[model samples]
Target: MNTPCDIPALQLSERSFGLLRSLFEKETGIHLRGEKRHLVIGRLQRRLEQRGLHDFESYCALLQQPHETQERQHLIDALTTHETYFFREPAHFQHLREQALPNLETRPLRIWSAASSSGEEAYSLAMTLADTLGPDGWEVFASDVSACSVWQAIQGLYPQQRLDNMPKGYLKRFCRRGQGVYTGQMLIHADLRARVNFFRHNLLADDNKLGEFAVVFLRNALIYFDATRRGQIIGKVVRHLRPGGYLYLGQSESFSEPLTSLEYLGGSIYRRPSCPAIARST
Candidate 1:
């Protein structure tokens, strides 16, 4: 179909907003309210033109085509914002380094960066774990709902400013400062990037054969969803964690329905009960 180049000031109609909302919810489980109408259209408009489409209506029709599955992927790329940086939450990293990693030495360690936005969080986990384990055989998998984020994570390159809050030791050890033509940017070492596998996944969707993980980081992302959906997503993730594994939530997020068979290990951390440690919650 012939499409027009993007019109920067293009207005989004109610019908267009509805189409964007449906696509977002289906792909990412993030329900965009009507208030975010402008945000969605503005961000995605340029991407439509990049794909050589002139208008949102044509993009919508493309998404509807059965063989245009790749178009839906592009829609996700355009719509989702991967605004993330290294060490985004310091306390979570501290806890992982001080408590979680030390406690996992006896077991085969596998961590899931469940809401790995832009790959920084997952790479951070891999760096911390690799530092602790030292070739002790551990794996980290980072997954995100955003197709663009997954691609960037795999690329392993980022702006230098993203490391503003990162510790000097970590900056030196895990990342190479951008130089020459690559000035003002940094890239994670291939060794570290090799340790993390980035893939597309929606938390609200069926669990793929993810196997089992020793720890699952389902932070920050839950804030976007309402309580009921959050609980459903949490329940699904916890099942893929092995017994005695850890589930970490965002500092501000809390569980309304306390998960059974998990011991509250203080703060927002919970540990799966090992064997007879279950205590019924009244």
Candidate 2:
């Protein structure tokens, strides 16, 4: 299955690009094409240098060693994942404030930030929900595959720089500027922090039934998977959504074929058809 293009520029040998591609593909169902030869080398070359690996063969050997399990995860963490900011897609939050939350009558309204990289998306949700439902009525569940991101979310501290995308008034209201020894950081308000639960979870795998949620924000994460894998992952996550709940994808994504049950409300929003079974419970 190896192709000539998979070979690297400096190395005449087949190199470890095949092994790297296979590893990421297995873990995340993300395909690394043969043409990405330079990209593979460019991304991981620093890791090799840090570990004193002179060639791709040596890197592959290290990855195969059982003790290097955490190292492999570090590799995937670096190669994939994107930067997310508070209100990255501003319109979604606007819609939630003006439209969605007003209609829900359920107690303890649940929302899932399914790909909440580094907690901004989840915190935004918590802030809006707190504004709407107040202190006692709602909760946010935020999760990501990276252990590092989950830890950051739990700590609830961020560089003041990361709040650049946040609105000035909203920022002042929800965040506290670090002082003295803690300068240059912003700490999330304790109220918002308490409303969110952070955890490490891979969206490609089945998660334990935390609970059926009223809304799910899987945004921007599915673009990494191949089309077939995208369908499967979407289906699995949708199963956890309560009937009539909402699911939001990145604005760039649109479903076809089997996921047609969701009614598109434009701009990446979809509504799940209400189930008769849930109607009886209601």
Candidate 3:
């Protein structure tokens, strides 16, 4: 089973590619178009090499086995995870600070960062909430489908360059610069890290109950899915946002068909109707 692969010469056959694209779509609701084939190969090349598998076929075999949960996770991580940095979109966080916080009816306020990759968005929200809410009544809960991503987010470590987009004072106040072996990296301050919770959850499924929140940051990731899948994912996500709570999507993302409960506020911000006679599905 362990055929040594020539990493440079490795190729994903058309059959293997089709199987994988379908499998990934079935499991994660992400439609991998033809253009993403190279992206998949590049992302998964390390995984194939690590498994000592000579081809994508062998790797796919490993993933198909029910007992290969960890290996399957590695595949999902490689395909589903996308890199994100601190304050990737400052305006969304600005709206959270300026608008979302002022109209809270709930106690022990919570925010969900859906598809939170590597914790930047969650930690950024944590800092904003800590500054404005004074830490007692609020918490940020972040989840991603990739176990690797969730693990990285939990570690609270990142290269310092990724934080370049970070606002000026936040770096000093909420994080510490790496020294010695970690010179070019930074670690989120322990205090800020503690306020944010990171976990692995797939938006394609809704069995896991994350309590309702005052705001949900479900950004960028939606663009990868087809409209039907997008609707399903958004439908599941909106149920966790309390009526009157806000939802932030990527600036480029929006629904093909509007939900009756969600009212579009500009800048990719949306709010659930404060008075909902019934739950509305997208």
Candidate 4:
């Protein structure tokens, strides 16, 4: 008579909770707050069932195996990927399309969606840039710590409702409505999908090889990190920004202390001073 919903959730003990959460923080730099205990249990419950593990303690043991890379990624994906949709924040894109690109003298016009979850933000940036830049060469690089999210993003498939916030023009220009057995689904247009590159990257590590970008959208995801880690992440990420480049954060995200690297430009936007201005001021 017990339905799946009626089945009691897997119990996570205080010791196992501390161990698993610490492992998560070490690998991903996200501070799993104590209040997120229920969320963690609910999200990770299936993983335990599928692994044939009876409890959270056993799951924690499996996670400790060095060769369990896929399982490790599953943990990260389950915990870190929050709800994201196309054009979630319109102002940042508007700023890029209307204000930043106009005055920008950079040749390549490279941009990074530093926390692109499921590729929505990156694709949004790509579509906006491709529409504006036309045949001119440009780059939109996006990365996430969640391997599963990276895989989903690379597929570029979504339910049609995901486009609700997308402008009519972009929907026509950048997406193809599904047909046949795939009804109610939409796919990012091949050209638009090709414009945005997706990869798996953890912000806790500095990937200097990605080179410099003219703008980096670190956005709303920073709220998951603690203050010290937030500063460390910002400092490392700023190293990738070209001089005069801009950084956009979520409107809700703010620092506990001043950031000496970038000048705050209001509306949660910050700009790095150009080389000439830096030299002149120095």
Off by over 4 Å in 4: 1-4, 276-282
Off by over 4 Å in 1: 1-8, 52-54, 276-282
lDDT of 1 by residue, 140-242 (tens): 9999887778888899888887788877898899889879998999999988888898988888888659988989998888888877888789888988878
In terms of TM-score, which candidate is stronger, 3 or 4?
4
lDDT tens per residue, model 3, 149-264: 99999999899888998888888889899899989989999988888989888898875468788899999998888888887888899889888899999988866767667877
Q: Candidates' lDDT values, in order?
A: 0.80, 0.80, 0.85, 0.86
Q: Write the per-residue lDDT of candidate 4 for residues 1-282, one digit (tens) a residue.
A: 222687688788999999889989988998788888888898888788889889998999999999998898889989885578888779888998898888777878899998898999999989888888884678899999988888999999999988899999989888889999879999998877887889989898978699999989998888988888888888888889888898998888876767676777778888888863552210
Give candidates' CA RMSD values in order.
Answer: 3.6, 5.0, 3.4, 2.5
Error of 2 at 56 (Å): 2.4
Collision count for each candidate, in order: 1, 0, 0, 0
Total backbone clashes of model 4?
Answer: 0
TM-score of 2: 0.87
Clash pairs detected, candidate 3: none
Q: Which candidate model has the greater TM-score, 2 or 4?
A: 4
Regions more than 4 Å wrong, model 3: 1-7, 277-282
Worst 10 residues of 1 by lDDT: 1-10
